[model samples]
Target: MTATTLAPATTEVLIQLRPADEWLAVCPLSRLTPGRGVAALLPDGRQVALFLDRDGVPYAIDNRDPFTGAQVLARGLVGSAAGRPFVASPLLKQRFDLSTGRCLDDESVAVTAYEVRAA
Candidate 1:
């Protein structure tokens, strides 16, 4: 699946063996609680964090926090800012946009936002 990441020209596809339309299924929709997140490992060993908002909207992003390089985004707090959903990094408290994966505090940097869906 296609994901929006920093530097699209240099972005790498981690799950190569799977078909383009398929992504590693993290969990069932019912298993994801609101205001929380879950982490799933890709075939390439990279972890992707999946978040479902209180309103039942799903979002996916790289689990590693760019600032501290720790795999902890799934433990972040979920909330909304100005009607836009976001998650606060549990370590440094940096807020990230759920739909875009853009760090709200620093616009220059961002994590990868995966293409996800609930079936």
Candidate 2:
């Protein structure tokens, strides 16, 4: 019997964000670093923080910090609390949930959490 060899598979993963009705392609999946974030400017001049978890899950949230009014969420520290992924602001150390964009320290405050996908 002859042996068959199978070719390796290759998939080009892309990261996308939906701020409004249309989905915007930000960058390739390779551009993101696990446990870190990068900032991207939307078409409407809004800044967004993009992250890829160690498990390859992508998340996007507004880069603006409502408490300090600073656009610095991308530089925040990425971590998990109670199985929920969050990013703690570098300046004030307030944690924001990556999926919901809700301030963990303050329930009444929240930022815009964009729909993110890796495809």
TM-score of 2: 0.89
Clashes of each: 0, 0
Clashes of 1: 0
| TM-score: model 1 vs. ground truth | 0.79
For residue 90, give model 2's deviation from the true position in Å: 0.4
Give the lowest summed-lDDT range of ten residues in model 2. 10-19
Best by lDDT: 2
Among all windows of ten consecutive residues in candidate 1, which has the lowest summed lDDT?
11-20
The residue-by-residue lDDT of candidate 2 on 40-98, one tens digit each, is 98888999999999999999999999989999999999999999999999999999999
Question: Candidate 1: what lDDT?
Answer: 0.81
Off by over 4 Å in 2: 1-11
Q: Encode model 1's per-residue lDDT on 1-119: one tens digit a residue.
A: 99967765643323221214665555667667888998877767888788888777788888899999999999999999999988899999999998888999999979988877775
